[model samples]
Target: MTEQLEKLNRLPLRDDLRGLTPYGAPQLDVPILLNVNENTHGLPQEVQDAITASVQRAVSGLNRYPDREFTELRTRLAGYLGHGLGIENIWAGNGSNEVLQQILQAFGGPGRTAMSFPPTYSMYPLLASGTGTRYVTGDRAADFTLSAESAAEQVRAAAPNIVFLCTPNNPTGTALGLDVVEAVYEAGTASDAIVIVDEAYAEFSHAGTPSALELLPGRERLIVSRTMSKAFALAGARLGYLAAAPEVTDALRLVRLPYHLSAVTQATANAALAHADALLANVEDIKVQRDRIVAELTELGLQPAASDANFVFFGGVEDPKRIWQGLLEAGVLIRDVGIPGHLRVTAGTEAETTAFLTRLRELLGA
Candidate 1:
């Protein structure tokens, strides 16, 4: 065998990954894709024009490396964040995932803990492993609400260095209300742990739900992570950021790669920012479609969680995997989350939603 192959075989990988199945996002080429929570709409024509113009300006500087600081991009992002917080509080990465990893690297490692909730984003646990940090979880209540007391107990017991809370949580589509989040945040603070709120779906949240950013005052240990991937429809460009106090941003900057955000990505995100109104309009439409899908699922005898995000989680029927398989065969792909008796589906375009509903009704004999 080659020298590289010999060394690879001899080296022992992380102990936790032993026998753990590798993860790859599902591959489904269908007329309707409801598996991943992606906005079905592309950037508007006006936004595309802006991107083209920005790209032209950037092309002349191809010989130079991207700005190591991503200062211009940060300025645009700080502007996006508005006067509420300035550039001192912002950190960006290739994606929100990387930003999350940097948080772990900065504060978490062997002998330290990273706490999260179950049926939340799977990436949290994976990210923890990459930093050699212990991953601890508090299971949500049966109704999918965050158990503030239980979470508090875990914080005290684990004494974790970092705690991740997913707002309008993934896989279940349930929003942990601000009061509960505050309770958890308070509990976590008792241990002097950092609380990272993963608000990847905040744009689709129900009105009146307070954003974590709005609650960041005096919460110096808090990091509210946001992504342009979901609401801005820029997943392809890979931009995500965290808003926190200057100290936290400084620590994150220490571990993050120098040129993590590319000029192309920075430019694309700036273009997207200029069309915020159009993006919010699309988000509202998704929310409307999400509500309708939840209702339709209920009428078909499926109990869906009260979702404030753009996806719906419904199940309690026979064999969610079999149902998911049937839907896939019928060309409608939904996410079969590992959670038993539960499946998550993203709301697509109106026509796509209709097609999925029709096929689902036929499959379930509704």
Candidate 2:
């Protein structure tokens, strides 16, 4: 390992890429794996069968390249989103991260800049780095919340070429109000910024939470990105899509590699979309578990943030590392998240949630 590290350092790597650690979470094989914020519930048997059948049908056409445009998948995604969106307004990539990277490639590079609030998604900076875009970090409240006024002010000040808004944000699990999106968009008018609202966990948000999709009609600069990984239990499918103005997608077309999405991937995602209701049934169950985690964690004297995502992030651990290790020893694994006193856990199934909670309680000696 030392030799490899020395050799890597000696190579002529980009100066900006030097000393940057890759983004990853611990991938431990534990009894209750709730670390990565994936849907704990496996796919419904029916959805699984549908995907299998679709893949089988697509197998014969393996020799041919997938439709570079992915027209059918875009249409299906638009119907699923249903904010009066159409195929012209839809674009997709292997995952939301790729969709975001493509955006940076199109709108940010060299002298251009991309900005996002910290303790948000860790990938924004990494993606910016990969695209050779200047990365900027904005501030959030001590409680990890961002207000519309603060966000707008920050956007106006930075005037970045691109802005990333992670709704029901990762790690922290808090959702931004549409007002923040509106404010940031208005503020970015001076820079003509492309604002992206990442809705990876939108399906798990509490009742009546409005989506940024509602704000996309006239906002050609705004993009709302979604993934089939969480709510649809299709993490292996690797399908992420966005809804934006046709012109914005047109901009992406210049940068995206031809036939980037594979035929099997399209089949799997399309089949999942066909069974959206069945696949999303687990979302309600996960929400129940998430709320349970928040309530029970509070009762145990931990300060869990209000979460609209599938995961719960809580502070008040006197020793986060100790608790994390203790939970691991007991065969339950959750994310330590590197925060001083906070840890994040994906809400799992009823039994899995019970396992995590019971182990956590035992660790706390409660």
TM-score per candidate, in order? 0.94, 0.99
Per-residue lDDT of candidate 1, residues 19-49 (tens digit)? 4444556986788888889988778788889
lDDT of candidate 2 vs native? Answer: 0.93
In order, the Cα lDDT scores of the candidates are 0.84, 0.93
Q: In model 1, which runs have C-alpha deviations exceeding 4 angstroms?
A: 1-11
lDDT of 1 at 11: 74
Each prediction's number of clashing residue pairs: 0, 1
- Candidate 1: C-alpha RMSD after superposition: 2.6
